[model samples]
Target: MSLPADLCERTLNRILAAHPDLVEQETPLASLTSPMSPAPVGSVRVFKGSAVAKVVYVGLVVPMIQLDSHMIFAFTPEDSAVPHFTLDSVYGGAYHAFHLDLIPRADLASHLPYLDAAFHPLSPVFESAAGIEGLTPAAIGPRQRAIMSPWMLVNRASEEAFAAITEHVDAYAAHWSGLVDKGLPDDVLAGLADTDLAARDTAVRANIFSRDVDPVWAQVSRLLGDETTDAIRAELVANG
Candidate 1:
């Protein structure tokens, strides 16, 4: 479906007005003819300078749409230089992780009116056949549900804190693997591998065990219960 032109203009104008730092220049459809020319039709480019003006695509725009229909935000030197405004936010959040496709630049203004009328306090619409309801933690399996609970809580705590926890998890896994490579005893390696089970076991005297882990697990446990946890734990134990 083609987005309304006036609404697109208004939304763009509003966003531009809200963030005065972004320099907005319209690249007329006729001006682009070469590789720079927007693929197919009904596509527009919003440029600050020599760097890629955001490429806005209205619905399927031919050869490119065969690859992906969603609009794309191509970053330029000017865009990179800015510290605060990231390509993600400008493009409507992280691309791959969230699978959030860029709203067509041409349709940004147009979509806003529909968004305002339909959705409450419209934000960036993530492109997914599985909508927010599908992505909700309750919809996932036990382990994933547990991890997501803590991640969401930590994310709410602070972005920096959340980043630190993620880094720690990565580092912890690497450190554990390195120990195994260095000929750590099988028992020790087994201990390292079973951190989650150890975390759950109240009788274990492991230093890594923390009460904090339970709250997150509890949320998942409440959803999936002990049976599922025990089943997963049995699989892990058998695999080990």
Candidate 2:
């Protein structure tokens, strides 16, 4: 599956437009720096996660960009919770956001066909190849495996963040189960369930969806098979 020629052109153009500096250098990930205040009209802050690249683009287009990081074992910043403000601070600002994971230059070449197939006008195809599901995670060609392994780890971290929340939910479920096993009265059990559910609901609505989870979900959906991904979305919706 080759990317549509036009989509390929557009994607390459966007990449070149975003990082004209790449033309002159092949710098390692460590060498990058966050732009200072009064940055470029459309500067980007790439937060490389274990498997995805979370791109925060700031400028006249959008206030900020958020996507999974592609860097291997990319460290979550200390201020990972901080909201990006570039969009709100500037007037008439909008952003185009997407995620990209590292692919070995070689694998990237072989997988280009599938990426071409996954081209979406609204979503860029830098994160993962499309139409390539059913290939075991390990069966991915070596070149792609090399590029994606780290990116997948970054993606794992994002998933782990949700897994952490799910862990708490699981614990809550277990606690409820224990109470039920102890033969608590139906009304009492119902009340306890309601209370816990209400608290989790509030936290998810006010914090998780609006802040952390939704952004990651959008990116993850693209990478995961539909059935698996939809189930995950159902959990978030139910919890939220």
Candidate 3:
């Protein structure tokens, strides 16, 4: 059983390296622990960059770095037509799933630039990812399905499969960084706010981090202490 702790670090390091200018915001809950473990359960970081968006990362791993518990990266709105840059992966015991995607701010079908860059180029490989279960492409809606790309994988993984997952994650993180690197002009951002974008943004985020929809709420709370864990979730799903 190989520990993929470096995988989580690789993703975080990639984001920080890719955007040297991002501000690392201080958070009270930087680290959390698992109820039954010696090392921390996971760690979290928040970064504020240019007009593009704010980046948030939360990751969990075993002390040996052998068992990657969970790793998540979310890039949220503040600038131009962009979806949240999100990546979710988990490998522990016999549970394995790999999901890497840029969730469209709205509908994927109409978000042409995103569609052209993220989906069209990568979907074929992702769609056919080997040994991945539940790699279903369904119509996006207000549910968790809304934020997922058709290529997202949910299955038991193999060694070769894990390696493939790591490679895709690295590339996809770079892909999302490029999309939001320059960000949109301030004037452009202000113009888009006319639709009460703030309210919508908050709602969209809450939907993403809401405990009702959180898969690891219980696990995280037990590990980090309910209060601290909830605070982290609040930060991730914050409103305008």
Candidate 4:
């Protein structure tokens, strides 16, 4: 397996180990390789648990262009204030492009305490990974970045730099798992109503997976077709 794929599997296994209650949920569009592609190229899987509302994993391999992609999202309950977890990595022989972030449940600018409780702990790990050599900025635009946390790590890395990212991925995933288990402070929760929290989580997720916001969806559509791409987007954005 490729370095990125190896880390993705290990990180996902760690998440499952931390949350033993999580159960794999069936997906109708489990097979992502449609007639659009000549051969079997990808698959999608979903899981659900008490602490984690839903988890989606998608893996894609296009031998024609030497592309391998693995993406996962573990979203906490919509009514809870915990941030969601997401990890995406795509390796195309020469370059490794990956993005990792804890998607905030509420707007950080308005909720200082929530930000401090959830994302602040991740600052050191984010900064350390940023300093890795041979890591270049990813093509994600400013608009797309606004929806995710400031600590998001999205970059194109050299093989050496990509290998170095595994430790940071483990750190971020571990920290997120802790948040999912213990949750945010009571004071932080007091000000935010459950209804509002759910609303924001839904809206933020819709925007994050929206094709208009993220250009990568276009590329995904080309590989998976509009119907399949939309189905996957619906899964990511769905509240239930």
Candidate 5:
């Protein structure tokens, strides 16, 4: 398996082990093959649980385009204010890009308590990983970056640098698992109503998955067709 595939697998394993109650869900996208490629090109799987509304994992390898990618989106219950977990690693041609983030459920600027409680613990690891050699900023535009957390690590890296970030990735995943178990502090949750939390989560998710907000989906649509791409998006934003 490729380095990115291995990292994604291990991170997913950790999440599964931490939450044994998770139940796998059926998906129409279980097997993906495009006419552009001879063999299977991609696959999607979904899981649901008490803490998680839906967890979507996707793998795509297109030999024709020299693209290898693995990504996961673990969304929390709409009623809860817990942030979502997302990781995407792709190797295209000679370059490699990986994105790791805990998608924020609230506006960090206005909700200081939520921001601190949920993301402060990751600051050290985020900063340290940023200093790693051979890691340059990714091609993602500022518009797309604005929707995610500030702690997001999205960068193109050399082979060595890509391998070096595995530990940091594990650290981020571990912190997210802790968040799932302990949840937000009482002070933070007390300030927000469950209805408001669900509303914000829905709005944010809609924006994140919007093709106008994220151009990547356009590329996906071209490869997998609009119908299939929308199905994948629906799985990612499904409200359990």
Candidate 6:
């Protein structure tokens, strides 16, 4: 529970450093507050880079810091076919859940080079992380498998497990930073407009928009009201 707050700040700092051009772009969710307290329950911002894509982060933090929910997603410019980063985490009580990956624009299995570059470098670290109870290997379940690459780290972990998880988080950050610095290739950029890649990418990001099953929303709503919960969901999918 305590880790999510620090993780949120650390993740944002790492991303800003990785993409220096990122500016604080506002969204409708900033004004919304938790029904439980006067202070804003959550915030949404766009981190836009000059050369790379615009990355958006939606963070929800509780007063006692008992429950924290945050997601950081990257949306590439229309002309780039690169996979954008996706990192979502929720911490409450003795449990924590994680979803981290460089979501592929297309089928992950079809992109061997990208997988090797992103996942292979961090493969050795996975064994130690798997030692946790709820977390298995890289992936599981159909929906996760479809959206996340096989190299991604998706699991539910105990609070104690999070200490080790930071290493995995740092590894993913390094890979993402490298990708942001590299940009896309000429051949991929050339065909981007001709293909429906941008549309596909947007649709993929839309999955996080509603997220009806998210327990954080229910908790926030119980503390606040329906309006606050609805605002959080809408701003998550909103474009900068």
In candidate 4, which residue ranges exceed 4 Å CA deviation? 193-195
Q: TM-score, each model?
A: 0.23, 0.18, 0.75, 0.95, 0.96, 0.77
Runs in model 5 deviating more than 4 A are none
lDDT for model 2: 0.26
User: In every candidate, how many clashes are there?
Assistant: 5, 32, 1, 0, 0, 1
Where model 1 places Cα greater than 4 Å from the true spot, the runs are 1-14, 21-23, 26-40, 49-68, 72-98, 101-131, 135-240
Off by over 4 Å in 6: 63-65, 132-141, 184-195, 210-235
Candidate 2 lDDT, 19-73, residue by residue in tens? 3332321212222222322332222223322111122222122124332121111
lDDT of 4 by residue, 40-132 (tens): 788888888888888888888887778899999998988878888999988988799899999888878877888888999889999898689
lDDT (CA) per prediction: 0.26, 0.26, 0.61, 0.86, 0.87, 0.65
Predicted candidate 1 versus true structure: per-residue lDDT over 1-240, tens digit per residue:
212222233334433443345554443432222232344333333534222223232211233322112222322222111101111111112111111211111112333332232221112221222232222222223543232211121111122322223222233223322322343344433333423332222122121112243343353234335554333223212111
Predictions ranked by TM-score, top down?
A: 5, 4, 6, 3, 1, 2
* Of candidates 4 and 2, the better by lDDT: 4
Candidate 4's displacement at residue 91, Å, is: 0.6
Tens digits of per-residue lDDT for model 3 on 43-161? 78788776435677777766453456655555655334555666656666655555567665544564455456545666655655654543333223445665456545445455456
Model 2 regions lying over 4 Å from their true place: 1-176, 183-211, 225-231
Span of ten consecutive residues with least summed lDDT in model 4: 190-199
The best candidate in terms of TM-score: 5
lDDT of 6 by residue, 1-240 (tens): 367656756877888887788787666666547546678777777666665557767777775766687888765665455666778787766578777777666554555554565456667665566776555333345664666566677777767776568877887777667766785555544434445776776676666443553454666668557776676556445344
Of 3 and 4, the candidate ranking higher by TM-score: 4
Clashing pairs in 3: 3-66
User: Residue-wise lDDT of candidate 5 within 120-218, one digit each (tens)?
Assistant: 999999999978999999888888889999999999999899999999999999899999999887889876643387788878888999989988889
* Candidate 1 weakest lDDT stretch, 10 residues: 82-91
State the TM-score for model 1: 0.23
Model 3 misplaced stretches (Cα beyond 4 Å): 1-3, 34-39, 62-67, 110-114, 128-143, 182-197
TM-score of 2: 0.18
